[model samples]
Target chain A: MNFDMILAAAARLDGHARHTPLLSSPFLDQIAGRRVLIKPECLQHTGSFKFRGAWSAISALAPEVRDCGVIAFSSGNHAQGVALAAKAHGIPSVIVMPADAPALKIENTRALGAEVVLYDRATQDRDEIGESLAVERGLTLIKPFDNPFVIAGQGTIGLEIAADAADLGVTQAELLVCCGGGGLTSGIALACATRAPGLRVRPVEPEGFDDVARSLISGKIETNAALSGNICDAIITPHPGEITFPIMKSRCGPGLTVSEDQALQAMAQAFLRLKIVAEPGGAVALAAALYRGDALEGDTVIAVVSGGNVDPAMFTRALATL
Target chain B: MNFDMILAAAARLDGHARHTPLLSSPFLDQIAGRRVLIKPECLQHTGSFKFRGAWSAISALAPEVRDCGVIAFSSGNHAQGVALAAKAHGIPSVIVMPADAPALKIENTRALGAEVVLYDRATQDRDEIGESLAVERGLTLIKPFDNPFVIAGQGTIGLEIAADAADLGVTQAELLVCCGGGGLTSGIALACATRAPGLRVRPVEPEGFDDVARSLISGKIETNAALSGNICDAIITPHPGEITFPIMKSRCGPGLTVSEDQALQAMAQAFLRLKIVAEPGGAVALAAALYRGDALEGDTVIAVVSGGNVDPAMFTRALATL
Candidate 1:
């Protein structure tokens, strides 16, 4: 958890990563009972924050490794991120996606000039296929999470938040970020600890998949039933990665969880009040803030709106539920 | 039109306007056969470019008039814009909206702290109601388009585009802007005429509402049976306003028309490629550039994405169609 490495990674990605707008909403501030700021990573290239880590990881590879290309297994955003990053580096990459993945994401991965291989999640193993492909082709497997470079890349967001908070006259505050495999939270916590040491970094997760929160409380890795039927397909059902859970537990602030309904409400609020389209996963952090009203009291909060690549159909359905 | 007045309005809105990001899309560029620069006004306050005009119009009022408050009739965005602008000035306001207006928009307008008066568009005259409301309350009526202040306010976007274009090394280009009552096109054309004379300013209309183009050719106001089933509820059906027609005729480049299918495709492309949510009307100009390839040849072209307030249902339907 060296902050200098994160800063160095930020320097390497100076022009590559978008300095996404830090959007402020007077309406959200009024509702949240505190000053609130939103970091819109949904507007990032490839429509997610994953691009930062993917680009950083791809760019950091040795010339020979880069030439040999890369492989990764992801259901959505990370697939697009890796695909686009590999294309940018002139590396031929193959992404193994679940057969049930959204068609738009599959098309986007292909559109970014990457090879897509679909694997049945129920009948076949995605990781095994990815590993075999990487090994056979002498290609590097870029893990979506659990990679130090990936963590450093995601930390760039924390750097931006720290600088932006300072500019907004915010000295200390709580930072809420959605958690999947804990990469985003772990990376962001590391950066916040280094840049704004007093700032609290909280990982917000879906109620059904609160493994990270449970793990944090027990001081050990925990598993939860693989949750389904959650509208936020992006972060609803993932277990914390082995490498990321420890870092997240050691460096991150208290973990929180919110129901699916709360996430829907937050997503709707974002659409109606902020006039920005945020995917369900993107709204989870805000959901936690809205749900944990008393917990967030007296704290100026920043919510990481992690991505905005929601399918139009899913977005409308989520809004209807709200 | 007085360029000085427009420039003054621009100056007044210097920091007030969002100075929305002019996003370049390599994906769209590859598809459209030309570089595409999108001015994302959908991300503007009130979810439309109407915010600029509304704010400018409200801000330009004399202190006495400001004290009196403001009134307006709109089906959607303009209502919210006036409501928000009046709130910013600490003036009470009333918005007269059709009874059948979108529920989200009506609620949003009221939430912005405006008094919303519902009227029957089929049986009663909205303008008459608005005028009476204004007269009875001593409130100023902020016309949706047909006003000098409003046009100048909308012109600020053109100023922003000019500055952005200079940074991108783009000069002498086609500027395609969506046209409803022609306020945005007239204002943008006037601004470009003064600021970048070589720029060709084209007003794009829905296939069903080519009134501005027809009027420009005939040298007189013309009316047509409003088309049915336009996806862009905000602008697809409005006839050109009297004040805007002359300016549009004199300053605008050749007006262009795009089909409903084309508009939906454009919206889809914007969401998929640029990761921005654009309402149908907001994407009409971009649709013209993308679908009317032969018509928009030459130097770099910019399309004004007028707004991003599509109903979630409409967006889903549009995406499904695409």
Candidate 2:
């Protein structure tokens, strides 16, 4: 919860994870009516910012725990992140994933040398299955967003954004972070609070799954009833995490939500202007910035594109939507 | 031609140009049989490395010359680069472009506030038309690749590649550079010869327009019979430039050529793995690295994805091919 933990995580991740490029586009700037700086974490290892938390958590484990290996449940990005981080640490990893997850994500997780355990999302509880597997196999469970190490790890992105913005002589700006279970948003809020106090942090979510937005307004946690219908699968967590919600409430401003069409437009814009591929979940913040320009409050705005592990068919569909 | 000019260009471009991210891919490494370091110029301003050269050339012009304006002939990337650089300098620009050029490029060039004059590639002599326009308007003619400042500006990318590779403990590698008129290739060759002495710099060209490759083997300048048939319009210069040829001859190894299919496949792979959009010409070097794996040497290899100003249809076609 403290800033020092994020700094320590950054120290651990230095030279290990990619310091992804902060890109700018004239076309995007014109649409938002402000200069837009994109922190493209799609370029990060395993194609998401999840790797940072995964590596930080696994690498900090006790020798005995490390030897016992680890287990996690994710539909895609987190699975690949934990799998790759475990492989780098020369430890075994078992990932419990939904059977209907994107084929690309499942294949990539397996390609990273993780044992895939598929469960029917509608019939089985992923948490129960993952917990039992971890217990029976004597493995440490790496929670996707609820873990302290993961939050601290994701905070490294905020550190980079502050540093990069300062390098450009920008002392004040607004940050739009794509929100799922509030891990990335809260982590970034904490980092910006300490590293660049002038920044105004906000969370962006898809329209149907705006738990974080409603929670911020209500000053409490909220849950989404339907998740399988949204295109932003990577960020369709049922509700904000218990640990992450308080930090977001204290540090973040009101959240913003974008429509599916807006998200698709943002993805197309990222491809056309910045030349980076962005997944539907990752492009939500950018969508808010581009489509919901009325909320912009600074000369410079930063959008965190969280992941790009998209199936080609989905990517084609996004382009076709544009 | 000297390294000092490149250093000076780097200084001039310190805060103005993007120090583009150097990306690595495990999938690409598996294909090339070595670690592949990608310098994605597609993320650069104006969607290509041409911006560096254009800025270098335009920024160095005399006040009166800049006031008189600048003119250049290009298929697309260079046109947009020159137009943007000229606009930044508060000067007018006129670009002579092929009538059949991609609509996106032409639209972008005009959007940057450039005057576009179209000429037929099959009938009209573009060079003569460009010269006549320059003379009539009393504008400075900015030759795309045959100029010294532009070459030095492009050389900055080589400096970055060498520094980034060394940071990762890679002192030796084979460099695959996309070749048009040898500006980018020769500039990189001189840079590698000076900065990373062990790097084997090789030029990559399209199959039918392999003048650079033929010239490197024959120890003389060569020319392509036809120019309008190739899909890589951005790099279909009939022959290597008069100024760039000497630098390539002295500092570069033999050039390599890839078929159009290979280039398209490379573009698709860039999208699937690197998550960057690459034009056909820009992906040629990566094609050489991926398809011509037998020519690879050392533990590390660097491929320059030069530009991303590709038409969406072309990009869709590339993805469909995979």
Candidate 3:
């Protein structure tokens, strides 16, 4: 919610979250026609940036509340992140996930000591089930993006990007973030607004799931017609969060959207040039940087690869693009 | 070749080289049945730790010599590293590569402004061509592993591991390194000997290409029966380095070898759990950590993923294992 809170969250995440590398390649630079630097949060705990928010929210809770247990609803990445963070603190966690989510996510969450409750995405409401379960078990609900602590936690990434940009002698650049519910985008926008004012934040999403991009231009929260069918399953949200929309409206630049094909291509490029595996959702921002260069400005562009919890079949499909 | 030179290499690489991350995963720990820590040098520049040695060898040269250029011969990773390092210094570079090497590496080497000369691995002598080219062009020859400066450069990784281990409260562990001509293993072994005395470095290689392992047991340099045909082309050297073997024999622990299947499985595990790409050669150490655990020790084990310039087809095959 604020810079001090972000700094506080950064302190709580110390030793728990990975300080991921800011990577670059000449091949990537040539393709983007600019200096492209990447902050790969896929290397974060639980293979996503969600762990930062999960840790920030869970750690800030009172001992009694946290001990009572925590619960969250996620398609995949956030489920594993919260599961791992709760397991680390020796607390019980309940995760409500869509039944069709990647099998790896379901198994990993359970492996991390979480009770995974799967529900039909088309027929059942995950939030309703999660809330009822939380009430019955005295579990604290940790939302993916709307929560202040979660935003502050994700904001820590902006702090890192700002520091790295300055270290690399980059005072100005467009910081592109993969947008789902806009938690990551808003948090980073807030951080850069204060720390590296010269750097602008932009949200990127899959073509049909470009609610954030639409919302930014309309100056109001916009909703997507469909969410579940996209290849970028990790970032397909119905709409931007209430808390996140205003931050993007005020502090972020116009949003960008990339096709599923571009996302797949970006994943292959990431594999070949950067030696990093990026899930489709995680590759969207990079996709924009690489394929949508005509609309972008700046001598240097920083893109955040937000997650890498992709299934192998999908990964192989992405690799096929190469 | 020594700790001081490694320290000096680190100094020169302070801003130039990526201070690659030391990653860990509960999934990897569960598989290895021990606390598994990964130093993913695959995330290093040019998709391998070879860049460290290349930069070290090139940067330490006198200004006049460095300005003229550098030359190196390799299967792939070292060629790219040397090419990129030379390009960064605005110096011309000549890379002699195997005619059958990965097409990606050959194209990348040429793309990085290096004149790549392809030679037949079965008949042509690479050293003679490299030496002749260096002599004719007034270029300093940067051997992949045999040179003292190159060893010192690769040893910088050991210094990093020592510092990271100390920070994480790990004083003693088996540091598994993917062995090529023993450059990385020896460099890390020598660094750990002085900096983190409790940590023991072990060389890991693919089966049939385990010359470093056999040489360590015999207390003398040993040669592999075959020179090519392995999928792990990046690390299939004929023999241990003349300079590196003595240091590895003196300072490192007993060597370990893993089957190609295990390497492929480890590559999948790295993709699934660690979210980093690992070439089969790079995955051998990780393979040893996971499948060859019976031969390892310590409460914690560190595996260095040495390179990740894998072809898409091979990467797809690795993913199929998941």
Candidate 4:
């Protein structure tokens, strides 16, 4: 991946996506024993970094393709991101959500002027359905992680973080991000590598779906059958995407795995201490930072709180468990 | 009261207190039938607008007075605010909290390095204890609302909103601020009246705590009996303070009240649409805008979400009730 492409995407999205604040927490600093910065993507439009990718991808489409609109298969943040971005570009968007996806996400996507299509994950393949719709309607398909425009779009977060870190007198630091399809981790790694060459990028995954870590260990693509075990719904992917895997392999540092309990604890901590509600998936990087003390030791680390589109029921249950 | 004083406070708190973002919500705008800007003090340090006041007040204290320490009485945001502000300034601070205060608030105040002295609200006089502590320890009493410094500090939020609104092409707007002891509402009113004279400042109160509104109508400090009710804990004030009443009466335009149900509904809406966790008290102004439709017509409005420190149990219960 060329850094220039990501920089061009950032330039195109200059005033579109929010330059989300690089929030500093003295409490987090005390815990890490080093300066800690939080890139609050939870504050981003559609409550995730997915908006960056969706906007970049949709905006870069040809006029004819844009006229035909776009289709995406996501059950959470990416769904809302595409819905909102497509609306902003005056394009029709259809989001294929799992039958049991959070009601808030479904409602929010529809509210953002997207057509909501529900599918039972156990009985039907969402990707096949999305592709069929795309072909039948002559619409563009915006993959959540595999698209280059998406990666370049999410890379803008890293640019913001690098600029902020420099402003805060932090030239070098450890950056922790949650890995699912690896879009955010890879994008952030590429940006950090080019902008702050000395910065170390660590990608963390939940224990049950540690494909990225396993793939790194085995030096190839890895797969897992247990996609929806104890891991949070947003990060419970079976494997990394083909497009994202190469970026993760080349740019990301060693990957780490955190337990479900740790992620829940981190979610509670974010809510209680930071007074911000971070969905379970969004809190994984923070969980790794807090529980994986040895890995983060003596490093000025940045934890990407990727999103906050948590279901109220799930939030209450997590709070109870915590 | 001076524009320069507010500007100076803003400058002093440039990095000390969060320059909390003015979040725009199309969902809120559609529901309220006007452009809605949310000043998320829920994202502020110590989880409330109290942080701004406490930080500004403490930062401007004479060096000798700061060294002598400070005392405050509260079982809510102010207690945490004073504790954190004092800790930030390296000054010893004492807080008088009710014995049955939320465990989170008590823990947070102690965590911020304040000495917590528990008092029984039903049987003991908190003011007596606070005054005694101030006299015995030779500490300055940092009154939560009945202080000019605190009001001036709180005014900085208004200054920020005015500047942000102007940048957003808003010349005049209705500012809905939740009224507790009226420190925040009064401060905002003063700042808006001075800086953005065309701005309309509206104070919102919970149904049972309409002292500010009543005082506005009666043209005097109207006292209300301390009645037990199903109101949010943070803004369940019995009456407005002496210092804040006059400013609110003179500068504030009108006051409105919403039912507990409305507050709960608004809180849920904030969670679902804005993706921000807003405690019932913090959601009151937005509740007024959402429910008091005819009262807030034909104007762009800014609602100040003053805090987000609700106990997890209370938050769940509030949502369940809704």
Q: Name the top DockQ candidate.
A: 3
Give the higher-DockQ candidate: 1 or 2. Answer: 2
Order of candidates by DockQ, top first?
3, 2, 4, 1
Where model 2 places Cα greater than 4 Å from the true spot, the runs are A100-102, A120-125, B99-102, B119-129, B132-138
Query: Taking the tens digit of each residue's C-alpha lDDT, what string does model 4 give over A1-322?
Result: 6688799889878767877767655666666667777777888887888999999999888888798999998868898899989998999999998989768668878999999999998999987888899899988888989888999999999898888788778877778998889888888888888898767888888886888888988879899768666647787777888988988888776888888888888777777667677888888898887778777745678889998877778778767864
Candidate 3 wrongly placed segments (more than 4 Å): A99-102, A120-125, B99-102, B119-125
Q: Report the poorest 10 consecutive residues by lDDT, candidate 4 chain A.
A: A23-32
Fnat score for model 2? 0.50
lDDT of 2 by residue, B8-79 (tens): 889888888899878877788888888888999999988899999999898888898789999988757888
* lDDT preference between candidates 3 and 4, better one: 3
Output the better candidate (3/4) by TM-score: 3
Identify the CAPRI category of the predicted complex in candidate 2: medium
> What TM-scores do the predictions have?
0.87, 0.96, 0.98, 0.93
| Winner of 1 and 2 under lDDT | 2
Docking quality of model 3: it rates as high
- What overall lDDT, based on C-alpha atoms, would model 3 receive against the true structure? 0.91
Best by lDDT: 3
TM-score of chain B of 3: 0.96
Q: Model 3, A24-112: lDDT tens per residue?
A: 99999999999999999999998999999999999999999999999998758888889999999999999988898777668888998
Q: How accurate locally is residue B47 in candidate 1, as Cα lDDT from 0 to 100?
A: 75
Two-way lDDT contest, 2 vs 3, winner: 3
What lDDT does model 1 reach? 0.82
